[model samples]
Target chain A: MSDLRLEEINSIHFDVLKEIANIGAGNATTALSKLLDAKVDMHVPNIEFMEFKDLAEAIGGAENVVVGILLTLDTGIDGMMMFILESDSAEKIVNSLMGRTCGSLDEFSEMDLSALQEIGNIIAGSYLSAISTFTNMTITSSVPYLSIDMAGAILSVPAIEFGKISDKALMIESEFGDKDTIINGYFILIPTLEAFELIFSSLGLM
Target chain B: MGTVIKVGMADLNVCKAPDALTTLGLGSCVGICLWDSVAKIAGMAHVMLPDSTQIRNNDNIAKFADTGIKETLDRVLKLGAQKSRLVAKIAGGAQMFAFGSNNDMLRVGDRNVAASKEMLKKLGIRLVAEDTGLNFGRTIVFYPENGNLVITAVGKPSKTI
Candidate 1:
């Protein structure tokens, strides 16, 4: 690894990051499809080097209410993984899981919240596992922490973590949607700079 | 008829009366608002970290509570506002997620709030009103014309202070 920095990440680095996102999100989408028993489609992953100001806008608007599932990567990569869904999409997924309809995010019961966390746990687990297998690294994540709030606010958690080291964050983002309901969810992965170095060395990219 | 000036994360700006300052999605970030009622000048800083001295990447002064507040105060004073007449109102700094880990980053909201207050005190800026330290995110708009800080959040009632 040639001293990789957020500002110095080139197209080749982006292409490799995109591939990681593709494989990770692909596996995650499969798990989601199985859990929902519905067809789920994923868009091509995007590698974004974004300022903190633009991070919130990536999910529509800063004030837009969202359901965020956060997990800390500990073992092989010291970083964070987040699963974000629009309020309506979250509600839809929860309702489907419970075989019933829920009104809004504000009215989500304890059971509903638990169900959402489980969904995040499974999807994030699959995503990390895919990356670990591809990179041949041991990656483990903490239990999912669920938060229902503004997208900007929820996104700040990752932004602050990244801001400590760099002005901009290199994010691997993927969008997954359920065909029947057209519900969309976003999965974002942010690895520390050191983690990136490890990944590149493991893959012989450096 | 005043335009709304946006303050992005880790950024700060100053505006005069009729012009309001606003910042969106303050999660674990503090929005420090300084106002000069006599001159109708207002400034807002969206600070992400508690202290700049603790971080190696400290080029952006506005990214830290200590430096961000001082810089904002300087800007407002330069805009024909008297330092003695400046008052402050702050918002944001909410714990957006509940985590069991004892990581300092997770408690950054509280630290940001504390650091902001400390800076304001050092500058002799009276913190008249504050809406902070909760488990939610806030979007704030500050009107220097009336020294009002309007706060809004998801599933929560909007309030003005």
Candidate 2:
């Protein structure tokens, strides 16, 4: 077997991430459509691999973000994807789900948090599952962790962990819907070094 | 002279004698260390989450609060140090997330600190000091040579634990 190197492995990992996100976006669109009772068009705009710091900056335009991670049993086989949305967009998603035009924090119910977690769970899990299928790997995901906070704290995470694993990271930006309820998502894919090697070797692409 | 082994989230750094171990910018996370002043041996860990409940068979044992702390303690003991001589000092548990003033669920940082203290007590370890809670990031330095815990917070001077 040839030497297992990062450059050889990362390309394959990036491709798998893109294809999975492409398929998963369809799942997200369908779920949102059903939830909102309207057609929500979701598009995966860009898929690029960059450093964790760069991915953080790209998602910085938003005020509020929904961050989630989907980890598999395989140590290196985890994927993390976060949704960055302006606070207004997040409020809109909640309002639309609650069937209200505007609602205060007191008016907001636990149902709203559940609704947001459900959306994040579906999108993050679907993306990881789709990627696992393409890679011919069996992976399981934990219930997604949902947090809504300022962009800074959300962005600071990858810098500590993900950046140490890969020189550059895989990312996809998706835009969905056309109504006042436009939803945009930034999907990131960062595989550990061992997982990166396994994908390429398994695909016979190394 | 103490050697400082700086650790980060989900990471652990170990050092022996004349060494001071440390972890910085700990917020909503826990920093743990087991040090033997007489033996001048120590181990430090910075864990982001509370438990292994989120994952299974996660060999990265340093990513959780109780497991990481216990692992560090074991290592410090293995370095020719007796368990009775081991002492613990912890810092960091800042509420980094800004939420509604009434939102209790946002107290992840506070929860982490409380959980760590309780776990240590259960383990029969003496916590000589702790600088936790509040809303500021912390830089922790563990001096193994003298069992000195130097804790420095943002906008605050360094103080011994």
TM per candidate? 0.95, 0.54
Docking class of 1: high
lDDT at residue A14 of model 1 (Cα atoms): 77
Fnat, one value per model:
0.86, 0.02
lDDT of 1: 0.86
lDDT per residue for candidate 1 within A101-193, as digits (tens), equals 656788888999999999989988987987898789989999999999889899888888888888887655666775556566777777888
Candidate 1 per-residue lDDT, tens place, B93-113, comes to 898888886866578898889
Worst 10 residues of 2 chain A by lDDT: A62-71
Off by over 4 Å in 2: A1-13, A61-76, A79-85, A104-108, B1-161
Clashing residue pairs for model 2 = A50-A169, B3-B18, B3-B19, B3-B20, B4-B20
The regions of model 1 sitting more than 4 angstroms off are: none
